[model samples]
Target: MITEPLEGFLPLFRSWFDTAAMAEKVGVSGSPENLLVELDLGPMVEAELRLLNHTPANAAEAACMLEVVRQNMGDAGRSDGLDLRAVAAVQRWLADQSTNEAEGQPVERLLRRARV
Candidate 1:
């Protein structure tokens, strides 16, 4: 979905689907009773979400995203550094994805890729 000035994110989708026997139908498509695959989601997002017990990331300033970016951009000096910029970017993204918005907002999605 990224188009302008794109950046790459590491993929960390779920490993197996048959490992867990789900009682509810979490599949958005395909056969509900028989899962064809597990949910796939960004690794960083998955970590943060799991800690929150699936709670949506709140606040316009996401510490987790900024930290991840900082770690990824480590050792880069001011001319090549991005600490401040990354934090700002995460803030903007979180704001745009706020669930408290009026309606039809792009809230943060909790999607985890699964394989069955």
Candidate 2:
């Protein structure tokens, strides 16, 4: 039955479904949640980096790539796909950058390094 597969997976899917429904109900234009679904996760990672002001040259490149991905997604009329690895990598890099900044290292100097 159609319910068979859902019966097993409903618990896992329920939260996600509820979130989507709530987002729709809120219906705020240009909300981050809406933009998030429209944005490639890779570029979203870069955007997060920008927010943290930890944009290395490589991170800038990644951001540009993500922009292209966003454009392509727009053209294709599809939501941007999420890449968990890219998000994690960017988050880790941001954390490292924050640590370096706290240690009194200039962000510009750290950006030029092989490591964050």
Candidate 3:
């Protein structure tokens, strides 16, 4: 189950999924080549769509959506396929949602590893 804060963050995160000019607002500059954009996002598109449509039935379901977004975004960042700023934003949000120390550790570890 997610807390109020986590629940509230869903809309904000969903707004950042735009692939057009909005990408610039999210700190990703330069337009992607039309033909390559789909391939660039790869698996992230489906997860992003789920959030965009608010399809998650509950907090746990929403968290799963975030996990999918996080993993795919991180993978995209590796080859400059996606923007790190967006990935960092997602990581920070995920880390901030942890209700306790134990719950936060894995997220913190991922954040640390990604930064390295």
Candidate 4:
């Protein structure tokens, strides 16, 4: 049997994050791991979300993904390999975007921090 692609859930998670305004509206906080636990996504989906979000070339995409991850993890500690400086950067950007929805903030801001 073929296993499902964890990345496939990225869009779905992103939609929820945007619709629910998870970070700001839900009062979720801390690293993505914490949010993932809160959202009850379990360890696997949480890991997949974090990897995809942190790997994205665009900051907004990364942020959007981060929001979902954070919402799911809640205020719990992160799993090994899930916590990194680059990952933290993406999470911070997502937090910033969640707080400021104004269009004035250039989208390029998101791409600047991308590892690629």
Candidate 5:
């Protein structure tokens, strides 16, 4: 199965980190894993949506996906495998996400830290 869309991808990554101790030794943070994926997904999802001609017909599903992405993005905890450059990209994306004071101070702090 392709899995249940947005949720399972994070776990697969976590499992990889669990086994790949070398990524840990090399200074990587798994904290931003989901956020990294979330950022990358924007274009991919858009393209897929375009191809399928699917306009997110279900409001609840759309809301769920958006919420999950935001939660992941905001979680700036240091895990493993996330480097400075990777975090920098996440920082840029988070900055873009903070439109019209939508994210508040805590999220801002997370964004700053994400810059590593």
Candidate 6:
């Protein structure tokens, strides 16, 4: 099924990380497995969001998606696999999301790290 909705894979990611951390805290034997599907699906979801011109539903979602874009963008001068149009759309949407000073910092920090 399509999990591209704002409430989909992102939340799953958060949950998985949280669960993993808790498991580790309890001295679990191993970390969460990096399933091949999960690894492969990230790029597909990223591409879908970019091509569809997806806008985040809220500040939290924006922040999350911005990270996705940032990772896809990589460090300075590394395009990775993201296209110019997609990057521009992501930038415009992210710019429109910074409604307050507190929220703006994360966006700025992520952008700086991503160099996008």
By lDDT, the best candidate is: 4
Root-mean-square deviation (CA) per prediction = 17.9, 15.8, 11.5, 12.2, 15.0, 10.4
Poorest lDDT segment (10 consecutive residues) of candidate 5: 48-57
TM-score-better candidate, 2 vs 5: 5
Model 5 regions lying over 4 Å from their true place: 1-8, 21-82, 100-116
The total number of steric clashes, by the backbone 3 Å criterion, in model 3 comes to 0
TM values, all candidates: 0.27, 0.24, 0.24, 0.32, 0.26, 0.34
RMSD from true fold, candidate 4 = 12.2
Q: CA lDDT of each candidate?
A: 0.35, 0.39, 0.46, 0.48, 0.37, 0.47
Q: Ten-residue segment with the worst summed lDDT in candidate 2?
A: 1-10
> Which prediction has the highest TM-score against the true structure?
6
The collision pairs in model 2 are: none
lDDT per residue for candidate 1 within 5-115, as digits (tens), equals 222221211211121113123533556554534555344334433322211134422444454445445536234334445554554455456433433322222121111
**What is the TM-score of candidate 6?**
0.34
TM match of model 4 to true structure: 0.32
Error of 2 at 2 (Å): 42
In candidate 4, which residue ranges exceed 4 Å CA deviation? 1-12, 15-54, 83-116
Which residue segments of model 1 deviate by more than 4 Å? 1-8, 11-65, 72-78, 99-116
Q: Would you list the clashing residue pairs of candidate 6? A: none
Query: lDDT, candidate 5, residue 24?
Result: 32
Per-residue accuracy of model 3 over 1-116 as CA lDDT, tens digit each: 22233354455454434443244345443456544334365434543543433434455545645554565565563353333333344444455454333344546666665676
Candidate 5 accuracy as lDDT: 0.37
Cα lDDT, model 2, residue 21: 47
Ranking by TM-score: 6, 4, 1, 5, 3, 2
